[model samples]
Target: MPKVLNITAARSRLTSLVQEAFLEQKRTLIGKHGVPMAALLPIREYEELLQDLEDLGDMLQAEQEYRRTGGKDFEDVVKKPKGRR
Candidate 1:
C-alpha cells in the first residue's frame, strides 16, 4: 500500500520522505486541506512508468493503422511469380 502524508507533515520531513521514496521504493501521496493533491516517487519508477505508457501508445497506434489498411495478411499482398518471372 502507498503512504499518505499531509502537506505540512511532508514539508516538515521532506528529507526523510525523499529518502524513503528512493531507498525503500515507497510511494507517497501528499494531501492539502484534507484532499489529495500530489505524489512523491522515485525518479527511476517515474521513468519506468513513462516508458511503459509510451510502449502501449505505440502498440495501439500500430493496431489502429493495421485495421485501417483493410487488415490484409502479408501473404495476400505478395506478388506471384508468372512462369519464373
Candidate 2:
C-alpha cells in the first residue's frame, strides 16, 4: 500500500519522504483534509508513468486520424493478388 503524507508532514520532512520513496520504490500520497492532493514517487517510476501517458496519447491521435482519413479495410491491404506486379 502507498504511504500517506499530509501536506504539512510532507513539507517538514520532504527530504526523508523523497528518500524513502526512492529507496523503497513506494508511492507517497500527499493529502489535504483527508483528500488526496499529489504523489511523490521515484524518478524512474515517474518517467515510466509519463511514457505510458505519451503512448496512450499517440494511440488516441492515430485513431482520430484514421477515422478522419476514411480508415482502410484490413483485408484490402492484406489480401492483394500474388501475381500483380
Candidate 3:
C-alpha cells in the first residue's frame, strides 16, 4: 500500500515526496478530508500504466471488429489473388 499524506502535510514535503517516489519507487497518496484524491508515482511507472491502457483499448477494438466481421482476418480482406497486378 502507498503511504498516505493529507493535503497540508503533503504540501510541506512535496519536494521530498517527489524524490522518494521517483528515485525509490515509493508511492504517496495525497488526500483531502482523509479521502484519497491523487497519487504520486514515478514517471516510468506512469508511462507503463498508460501503455497498458492503450493496449487494452486496442484489444477491445480488435475483439469488436472480429465480432462484426464474423472472425474474418484483416489479411483475408486485403489479400489479392495470385494473378492480380
Best by lDDT: 3
Cα misplacement distance, residue 75 of candidate 2 (Å): 5.1
User: For model 3, what is the alpha-carbon lDDT of residue 29?
Assistant: 94
**Residue 47 error, candidate 1, Å:** 0.9
- TM-score of each predicted structure versus truth: 0.75, 0.79, 0.80
The CA lDDT at 38 in model 2 is: 94
1-85, model 2: which lDDT tens digit per residue?
5656789999998998888879988678999876788998899999999999999999999899989998887798788699876
lDDT of 3 at 53: 100
Candidate 1 stretches with Cα past 4 Å from truth are 73-85
Weakest 10 consecutive residues of candidate 2 by summed lDDT: 1-10
In candidate 1, position 61 carries an lDDT of 96
Worst 10 residues of 3 by lDDT: 1-10
- TM-score: which candidate is best? 3
Work out candidate 2's RMSD over C-alphas.
Answer: 2.4
- lDDT order, best first, reads 3, 2, 1
